[model samples]
Target: MLAALAAGCPGGDQRSISGKVTYDFVPATYSATTGTGTLAFAQASKRPVRNAVVQLRQGSGVIATTNTDEQGNYRLVYIPEDDSGELSVQVLAKTSSPQIQVEDNTDGNAIWAMGAKLSGTDAESESGTTLSLHAGHGWTGSAYDATRRVAAPFAVLDSMYTAAKAFMAVRPVSFPALKVNWSPDNVPQGGDKASGFISTSHFSPAENEIYILGKAGADTDEFDSHVIVHEWGHYFENNLSRSDSPGGPHGRGDVLDPRIAFGEGYGNAIAAILLPESLYVDTVWSGSGGSLTAFGIDAETEPLDTDDPTPGVFSEASVHRLLYDLYDSGTNESSYDKVSVGLGPFYDALAGLQKTTPSMTTIASFITALKEQPGVDSAAVNTLLSRYNIGPITSIWGEGDSRMFPMYFSVGSYPYNGTLTLDGGYEYNTWYQNQYYVFVGNGSRVTASVNSTYDVALTLYQQGDVLGGSDKTTSGTESVSLTTQNNAIYVLVVTGFKETDGGYGISISITSP
Candidate 1:
């Protein structure tokens, strides 16, 4: 009997099944094979099924197994691992093929034909593509088709779009209807490209695009989600400040400005809050190597240096640490700081306004209202704080710490005595800890001529309550006079310095006209 069964089986001793799957009337593409084909089965009841497991079973032993593709077609291969003789096939949740016997005949054609006839009921209509996406209100451009040849089941694109729309709805401006394209090539290795980004022109509005890697939900990652949201955050900030200073005096562009730190931080925070499950998977997945902490940061131990620069707002490491602290096991003082304290109220105001107003239109209005109230820099902080609402942020520095420290200034001296010539210099002091400075005035256009008698050293910190100075040096007498176009303030401070002399000093002078 076993020999007879083997003789009747298709592919003879080799056991394999091939067919196509479809869901909701759409053909499902196989991950291993990119081909699409129609399922030809004699049975009509077993055509469309969901979550049905398809497998090749030999006797009681199950061989290779795979679930039906979303479109109800599945292919199963019988590997050498399973005994090849009498085979049993089954269809799930349907009465059609409770069990079917296939003989592994010496000539495999019969078994192959027997296996090929397994079919399912068709549950979906063979309808044409009628899906349409609208570019809601405040969208500047007309809709454009963004279809491309790529892997299917790109659900991440949908998630990114939903998040972006939600975020924009809360803002006070109209977001443009941007076309999105998904491609493995365009998908960034470091972050998701769906988050919106602005064109390079300093004043140009942001361009809208979303990119996704076609993969199963299990294969999709979290960085892409976070990055896409972060880009939207930039859009909110830029649109809010359209008429304000281009980049602010710091020279950092809209995205990099220190004033926008709150915005960046908020973006990350919102990403965390909304996608907590995704966050858990990314952080806790054993595939991630067990180093990911609850806050989605690497917690592996590493060496540290005393002189390393403190992480800035843009530092991924620093931002991760701060976020970890904020979202850690329990709340602490940092949670109630100015930035943290104001975030909740600000968010509440924006939410309330969003009910009656469109986001793009009302974002600026809501932000303006929040700024005019109290303790907020309406021109800068309100827009950012309201969106992410981390609460009040503690002042960046301590009390009595000079917010602005002077680094160099150009002024003529009867005797120019300073080792630091037209170039810049540094100063250090124990009292200057937590102190930052503003270097005011232009140094390049000093007008004073060479002189020996009158000596002058550029003052480091002069205006604020904090009194700090760099060591004096008498290198040569050169009357350096700098012409002032307009008084410009350059701020600096020892982010980190040794306490040896309480402070070290290097000579620097700003020449005056």
Candidate 2:
């Protein structure tokens, strides 16, 4: 259900006020090829503040209240008694939604608002009375004035409204409560959330909060719709689908952990799909708010040729491009991109097979699940996979791909040598930095060991659920023992902390007794 808005009483001497709300949105100019762009206040665009609460207040008491429609238009009717108090229109940076609240994390977590005074005489002046209120970006040609910067929170709220609409378009949703913390004091520094050092603009699954970078003259995401929706995509995946990604720093070109690539790329793809355009722009400010730079990319047209050098299943660039091609009704540059399943079918895969698969949520798992759904074009989908060199998808475990990709190792092969090494340029968070082994538990205790010069981290899981493992900080032999169920499949992962000091050598073994 939406908000419990008051139904205004209209009878004799019905006084009403109808109006529209709008905000200033700055635009960015980007290079389609390199994704570099510029943004300035001079090019600000006016956009609607939709799905927000609009109120007509009489002095301190509220005479009538209503919600803005999709176009930021609202109408409120109130009966006139004695002209004892003044009337004003107040708009809050909150939605009666699929409830999303944009709060000032630095200032008591309060919802932001701006007001316009309305006279009672004007309320009943005519049959169709209207009022217009707009929020400005507060730029004074040289710099920004914080007091006049009232549109930032409203801009952020609009993105969430767009995301809710995109999801509800496909199916009815009873969206859970969500809080978005934003403030001019929010920065990338790590500290208490109240002080506004949010670490970064990201969605925290632990706190169930999305923190947006709001420090001026550094980086602010209020105007960046893609960044907002990208984080929302994370929340959607966390709430609805399954995410096995070990979150960390990732880029478009780099090879990543399979789970991370799919997660990040899906975030990028969701922004492209839900936003008004396919272009994704993330803006950054220099030492002064007057100087702004942005990075833009076209998810629908980015190419991944056969000769491109990077991780195949581990490239977020490949993941987003493929997903955008699948959903958008546009022509793609990739020769293998002939499939268009749209968002509804794409979502079907996420809420269905992808959620329940035994394997970690990777592209292989998602694509395999997507193909299993009804009415999806299988042959065309395979063409796209073939271009990326992704193996044939038949199972959530990437059926028959281990021969070439070697994603999984067999527990039957004892005294196995792991091939994952610590390269000087490689970070420890990537898929190539770890090795995985799978085996069926015999309803008995099983022991696993990894011998290495550096710290060896080992984690065990059963059907995507974490069990228990060991990751000793000291080097030598890292071993873990655990009991397993009969015929239940279990996966063990080993990551080396060599730090490019030596080879990624470590004999691994798993035995049941």
Candidate 3:
């Protein structure tokens, strides 16, 4: 679930403190067309700190607090009924959660640390009701001041901006400002994971939103650059490029859909590229502290290479490994190590050719674009692709595969009929899918049907664009008919339910009168 926070109110207190919270950082140079720029790490400037925790205090006692909005503006309201004629309040900023709850809350064991006192104000109750104060770098010290524990948001912002800038550095296309929502209230209540609505952190594609969970003193995400970049990578894929990933619960070893494999694997690979870090870490918050796990692409420890002997065509590990090998400049023993094509070629391919490829968005489509990219060596590309068991990519349509058995059939004339058997089990059907290609004449009405021993689904496509599909009927039998122009190519895809496979017979007939 999304974080929903209301404004803070101190009842019976007739005065209010309102202000803005901001931080200073070096912004990268950007271009919307060429994506070439440099990082101004030597200098820095100030920008509003959004969703920061701001608090109001009365003589070391807590009164009220609220989070800064997207614009970094915040207001704390108080009633001065019982206080003296003048009320003095202290305004402070912390790097941790402003609202930490122990039970029945979304934020679990969250914290607000690395605090700096912003200002102190004295207001005449019921007389001078409003005062303005701004909390930022200069308000505490120099413009480039570094305060430990309180600069978590700085790291988060830096990683996000850096990644976006890197993208622009390659293919300078303008994208909308990303909206990030964070709060200490984004935790599960009473350690019940099921009742929790929001994840620790994730990128929502439909809403174009980023959510960060602030579990005070427990788990926090602002410090994990790899994790932040990984999530941002998802935003890049969905918004800037095209992703047909069927969203679901996936893990490292799961046999994923090809689309999901490509999307997840690309996200992982891009994180490492943006940061150029060998160790990728994810910190999980538990009680008072957190534990982290790290993985790598080229190294033996936590390597992207899979242990599964029969890791199929839809393995995320293979996709990420191939991508990492292609981008890594280090002279590792990997196949593509000699040819460090860098992130620029990959970005160009994704934003240009892969966006509208005729085939499904998979490793094949990406490799097809990569081969077409200028300055890329085809021999090195084949070496890396073949090493990952994805087969040597001979064409974008995947015509000549040395491994995993490539299958495609053509229909040349009307009244053409054929019989094919589909099987999937521990021994017979180890993989998840079976596909065939059909070609037909213009204005031809083509009808195809399937009869199988297990529940099956049928999808018809031209290139990668899905034209028609069927799964509504029962008993594993389905038929579809379509009419298109002369010599149009279509792919017939059939699969069992939940990766289950059994014998099936399919027949196709075409007529053009």
Candidate 4:
């Protein structure tokens, strides 16, 4: 339910004062059991007495009113309504002295301090509205200015709340809290020069705040709403993973693999799904004047080549293009003619996989699986292969390994784990013929144990070489040296044929030392 709005002032006139109504710092004592409350305002002896009229208005229309008691206290009924929209309370002071200005003092400890009370509702509704004040310590004036700035835009704040509520209904996963503030000091500025920031997007489970930049009567830009919503999406993704790692990079073999690309892609996807209208269709590859054929490979320059084995950049534009193609292809929806049409088949396939293999439900999971496989790098190529389940292993082992290309190889004696070394590391098996090789050390020295149980086998082959080797091994090292044939292309394999049940770790180092 929305908050209640005060009644309109009497008289149907052509002109009206439109603004938000805050009881200021006035304190009110109300009973939780009963929906009744009292507002108390202090009176100054030097100031002349006056009759104060307080009325609640929803938009330009008034709803209720009451006069202040002799003690400057007022009692009113609480009517719950859609006052979530912009509303204000107008105060009119009637004084006997013509020249004396009656100080309402409503902005002081009167309304702002006590806050508004809730009546005609349950305990939840009884809690008063709370506006947080965040001013850097030792700067009370700046703090007050910030508070006042946001205070002036209560109407806009209310509207934002309503909009948020609506947005949540469609995207329950995006459970964002509301935050209100006086200015943009808390938000980050563009290109490096900016001041304080206030965000309605909280990374934690707390409510978000909206800030009004102490500037009086200034309206927030429409883009601000979009930015806040996008931030909320980050929060949603964070919570969904239940781990902070999902929002950042992860380590892999002495390298920091960035997860931001995938994370941002998902965020953008969520944004598109939630607020399709908010995005400029023209900016998207699927939109007007854009086509999947132009994705990554510029149609004007590179031209589309379905047979191109190499992958290209998987930028946001490219990813969006793929998604758009899937959506348009009817793969997302069901239809015969549309089968394999656009990117729809791909998206639908991924969604289906997520249901059965929940681990693959997230983009991160898909990336992790791809990274673990051997030799699959380019983002665009990974996405393409992952879509068809023809990943690193499958790409090599399946379908005759059509994509297989030898990269490098090794064959020689080398120190094993900085300890025992081996010599005469040569194999006469058929597996050695025509196979790629990646050598680690020169074939000059031998320091490994002579016992057959401490021997190691090495082999090299292209993607289709998944089947020739025996799955038995123990202790040993294998290395092969190859010249730069076809740009450093060759494949090398090392195996320890030791008669032991325990597992051994092998280190592969490249370069001559």
Candidate 5:
């Protein structure tokens, strides 16, 4: 039973009305493990509903209007001094505009206000009043229609709205609106089959779509606020920030490609910051009356912080924990984490520096961006950086990195010769072996070769686009020859026949007849 409040004004003095908006929520179809049979809505629960517009009115005319913030609170001020004190508070019928309901392709019932009530006060005295709004719920027979009608999609929208508002708060800009497709079979065809909630959501820039899981039991994701925000975070990176991430399967403690590590870690870290809660949980369960599993971002269970034994610069877990350590006031009690800079600095780094970094978007580039911010103490920044076994903050190229393997050490100016060890850890994200970059002049034909006792292969690439490769046998040398068109840079990769490891010599020279 939520209502709007109308305060009284005396002697032409100004008056105000303020209140919070909350909704009676029912978890239509939620699973902690696997979603089975017919999905049923959970019991009614209450939570704040944000971004609804509220108005203070007299008779048929409006005095002032304001919209709720992320917390679902709003205030209307400067009402004319009404001697009669007769007034009413109203919640606008439409909570969102046409442009905002991109996901609801059918009917766009983006949101609905259940019902509204009004309160009146005696004339002549100036005082303030408060009230709340109770939102309504309805459903259509179609599964897709029902999803858009329920709290899951609304919750996802709310979380994304909260994140978008956070970015605009720091620097105002027009945020791109997109659709979120939530259904049991929302994932791509031939994609991994989900048990309950697909556990992952992906953004397709080409289609401008985000498909979420609405599968009852097997895998649905509407109720997982962090997962929603995390997916939205990816959308932001793809839209606003530069994502050079080689997209693939990744998770905690994985030695990912640096690009993938930063991109995924940024998403995970920001989700925690947006919620700012003590725990980041992803619950899984079976069908109705089934057992439940709660995967909390608890240090003891998912110890991703500095204490992680396999702390690699390439670890997504390390990247996520590092970003969280930088943005949150919470501490793991092992280091100087009290220097939490919160979301302002983190957002600044993401939207400002990381978005346009010259190098591949990696943790090194991210740290470089953080250090360049005015008034940021490099020492304090390094203190947190060092905790993850990364030695120090030097160049954005990640030079002098004693912890991470020397994977990207350049081949220097070409006509170049260098010796590299193709050790077992040289594999990047389970695909590439060891890749190194070199420069070549336009119209130049170059011979790139690798010599080693172990069976090795050689590949040539220009800015990640493979030019050519040569893999002859499993116990000798390999080489490839290509002519450059423009003044282009190239990358030389060394890999074993079977991802083996050993000493290798690489050479590149301008071809001469």
Candidate 6:
């Protein structure tokens, strides 16, 4: 959908059109509670609508197309195909290059936009025209109206713009196309996505789409800049970096799998790194009309949950705080926050070294490589790691920890038989929940089997890539067969289907041709 505005005509021999675009958004109160939160907003301020599609239109048809730059300015020059048609400029809720669209899920995926036109003789001006258009927040004293609701998509755009610019500043790269699904009907419910039941604001790796909540009187995220950047962070990690996390319900204080810890922590920290403010805030009202600002996290200064029994390498709070401290400039609140190598070094480790590391993606793996990056202050990194009681990550496989040392048992010869115990601790689908063994393949078809006290699962990996896996519903044992690749080293992972109490046995033998 497009809304129209007015523009001034010019007098130039060659026809040319140029202008700027902007949008308004209501800002969220920092660390707001019901007692401090209010519906009143200061909406006079405007921000440049960066990187959106801008079109020069004649009457109802598009005559030329361009993109708004970082300053929200665009210029178009084209020969007149028809002198009688009215001239106009249109800015869409979409961007060029790696396209990103904010769609109305409740409707038929309509793209919102702002357009401005010159009527009568102004349309046929010999010179050029300068146009300016803006998208309003749609707030009419008490509530937002339909016509003024165009700002949501552009607000989402601004956040994406901020995030993209931050990464490009740190490194040179192109982003993949992405679509953000948002609508007034989008709600926090379990149902069809098109029907506006967005469930929550999250990125779907399978669909490569982001779903945002947008129920007017209830939970709406159109103005939640941090939430938008947070989800975009997930998209970046999945596409640019590596994410081995098994998705599940997790919380700030919960001790999670190392993969989950890193994935979630990175997602949260990217927001702090990109946003002007380091505070992560989300606002929402309950369906019953109860005003409840969702949550706020001060990644820079929030105190860790001291009561959590296991808070070392398995905590997300520790992971994100560490990441922000690494890139953030000027750290004085704590002596441990001394390292300030900036986003470049961190980006290098994440996209280059950490991507192909043999270990499962985790905080330990990321920080281990982060310290190894050239010119990094390893002593500062070590000091920061010590603050969380996690220090000297010598290996991607998490060395130095007694529970993790001798990470992979080696089976040098054929007809290998071994029994591994994971009594240290077991949380279903966690990094420590499974045991690993390494062996050189002999180019013959082989069967790898695992027998355990509970339902068992087996998986094989070669150089950080999955080779084979077997997950049978039946309990007790599981096996997978794969032909060997000469002398290539392979890692076999064994785990119980359910929570495990103790010992598990593994057998790898050549299978008959």
TM-score top scorer: 2
Clash count list over all predictions: 87, 0, 37, 66, 17, 2
Give the runs in model 6 whose Cα sits over 4 Å from its true position: 1-13, 32-40, 83-85, 105-110, 290-292, 306-309, 331-333, 402-427, 430-440, 451-456, 474-476, 486-513
lDDT of 2 by residue, 1-513 (tens): 011122322325776788889999876567865647865677898888888878777756777788899888999888644664677778878889778878888877777787887665675586756888899988677666888888888888888889978878987776778889889889888999899888889999988888998877878888888999999888888787878787888876677878788899889988888885778888887653347778777775546453135636888877887778777665534577777787788788888877877677888888888887778887888787766667666677777344224666666643344544443336656765666788877778888887766677888877567797788666747888788788887878776556564456677767666
Q: What TM-score against the true fold does each predicted structure earn? A: 0.33, 0.88, 0.62, 0.31, 0.65, 0.85
lDDT of 4: 0.29
Note each model's CA RMSD in angstroms. 20.9, 4.3, 11.1, 22.4, 9.7, 4.6
After superposing candidate 4, which stretches have Cα over 4 Å from the reference?
1-182, 187-225, 241-258, 278-317, 320-513
Candidate number that wins on lDDT, 4 or 5:
5
Structural RMSD, model 1 = 20.9
Per-residue error for 237 in candidate 4, Å, reads: 1.1
Expressed as tens digits, the lDDT of each residue in 249-309 for candidate 1 is 1111112222233343444544554333213112111233322122232211110332113
C-alpha lDDT score of every prediction, in listed order:
0.30, 0.76, 0.56, 0.29, 0.58, 0.73
Q: Report the Cα lDDT for candidate 1.
A: 0.30
Q: Write the per-residue lDDT of candidate 3 for residues 1-513, one digit (tens) a residue.
A: 011223324425356667665554433333323423322334545556555556565544456666667566777777543443333333222222222111212333222222323333445434443443332322122122233223444456546766776776777667665655544445523343323445557777876766555454344555456667878887777666666555555666666656677777787778878876644555443433332222333222233344333343566767776677787775455444455787789888887667776555677678888888899998887776666667777665565454323544666766666666655542212234455546654666777677665566677777556678878765777777787767666666655553444545554443444
Q: CA shift at 467, candidate 3, in angstroms? A: 4.0
Model 5 Cα shift for residue 323 (angstroms): 0.8
lDDT accuracy of residue 326 in candidate 5: 72
- Candidate 3 runs further than 4 Å off: 1-157, 180-205, 208-224, 253-257, 285-308, 311-313, 331-336, 404-430, 434-441, 444-448, 460-466, 481-489, 498-513
Query: Least accurate stretch of 10 residues (summed lDDT) in model 4?
Result: 292-301
Model 6 per-residue lDDT tens digits across residues 151-230 = 77889878887887777887896888887887888888879888988788888988888888877777888788888998
Clash pairs for candidate 6: 11-127, 12-127
* Candidate 4 Cα deviation (angstroms), residue 286: 30
Error of 6 at 321 (Å): 0.4
